[model samples]
Target: ILIGNLFTGNESMGNGGAIVVKSNSKPKIINNTIVNNHSLYGAGIWMSCSALNVVLQNNILWGNKASESGNQLYLRSTGSTYSIINNLLEGGVDSILFETPYSGILQDNYMFSPEFADYATGDLHLTCSSLAINAGSVPVVNMPLYDMDSNLRLNGSEYDLGAFEADAAATIVSQPQNMIVMNGDIATFTVVANGANVYQWEVSTDMASNWAAIVDDTIYSGATTSLLTVNSYAPMNGSLYRCIISGNCPQVTTISLPALLLVSNPDGFDENPIAVSVYPIPAYDFVNIIHAAGSRVIISDINGRIVADYAALSSDNEQISVSNLNNGVYFMKITSSNSTQIIRMIKD
Candidate 1:
């Protein structure tokens, strides 16, 4: 029974690189570095006979034992009980696992990342995309809620898969300026960006930098190259409006004047039965097909799923029932024999 550390000088045994205890010894093995020791039996430190109750705290067990058995540390019916806590145990293939009918408690210990760092640094900071975030099977005696480096774990559902969690944060941006408009009473609006992009808008009353004022915003779903009458309840009041673009575009945002002057719509609309609001596209039940001044209609889904054949009826409105139909995702191919336009619709 002792209260101090004992530095063994038996490098000849080639097991206790730093300090190894073979016989039964009741010692407070605190804050020591056990390394670079190799052994034919227990490369790091081989223990047999005698009860070795150790208070292994802040100690390191690595690169020592390289025996045929456990390269790091080994215990073979040591007839000893060990309390290994807050220590670093790095093994080769078997890492840190013992099965000798000998049982002990292992906890608050870290065994991932660098798995091989300067023992003095104690910097177990793991990089993002680390596979060792939460991959341990054994539980510690008194598991430290935090890792060796004192970082919080499992902010979400469950714990990570290893020692480190790639503690990284993402950035979210809002309200980018990229619209063109004029000082008008009311007009059509079109939003455009360099690449195929999307946008949403917020209403503001002032044009000055002092934007203490705030207004509600509207979110647009899917993607549309052009939009008409882009007006919000809030008055433009000569205030510069903006269209924030997102998705697969440049990160740096851009702003433009309120879109009240110029206007634009989709190209090749004549292909569609103009004035004919094709309803329930990708329809199942009944689809209401509207037509222009003098027009007829034919429809088909992308996969050629269903084709509705109709005559050139001289009517402004027509109803095509498509009840007993399958359920899935499909696009609309509407045509008037003269011009054709493909409009995408979803099936319920």
Candidate 2:
């Protein structure tokens, strides 16, 4: 989050003031007032990657002109997955400076001017009758979803273009898709997310309390499948479990609702509908995850670095390897298409 504030006569301020982010990393720049700041090269923002994950939101990026290279704002992240959310990239030689941000979701925003007198005087407010009104996407992350300045985001149509709006009510959009699994086989859970990269999963022990993140799910990653060992252990009978998923796509963190499952708690009668069971809460070396069928398995270190990933697990009560691991905690995410079961391991 870098903002450029300078005192200059000409529009271009000679080099720098440009933003740079390399691949294999995720970053964001928001709500900045960059005017009169320029560079001979990439001034506004420059990114390069075939699969970049970033977001630009509700920023007044204009005036600070540049040329010879890069857009007044440019995009080197062509073919990458980035977003151009609600913002004002206007007045510059070219409004939006990008390469072809064709991946992430693009919504309502202004590429032209909302007519501001000057930044120092602070009259950048938008008029209700302005052309920038009601011209943006309904689902943006950080354009101030709520109109603290009495805009139209609270009670009105989908969304407004610029920073200020008429209504101020904001809502988050996340696709809560149900995952199904076979009674005895393993499965995987996948979601196509944009602007977000990290993910966390919460377990619901009590129905009343929305859902508490499983204590150690904060380091999880989004857009990937989680493994659940069928022959693993779970809570008690008649217990209800839900997976509350959330992550950082860009600036907007979306949670994938909850996928529920009921344990086969023997109501004093019989046991069915039960999936799998993993044993030894704190096993030293060998842990057994036995389900009616088979499942995939994954082993991630404390920092959420996947050290081991395997598919098409063996039959029920499969033999797991905890050798070559230090003495500490590790997360083993096991899944089948229907549900995901995360387990903790202790390697001595």
Task: Give the top-scoring candidate (TM-score).
Answer: 2
Q: How would you encode candidate 2's per-residue C-alpha lDDT over 181-204 as one tens digit per residue?
A: 433333233334433334445444
RMSD values for the candidates in order, in angstroms, are 17.3, 15.3
Q: Give the TM-score of candidate 1.
A: 0.30
lDDT of predicted model 1 = 0.43
Task: Please tell me which predicted candidate would have the highest lDDT against the true structure.
Answer: 2
Model 2 worst lDDT run, 10 consecutive residues? 223-232
lDDT string for model 1 (120-239, tens) is 554434333333333333332333455433544432223333343324321223323233333233433455544325454433332222222123324222213324344422233223
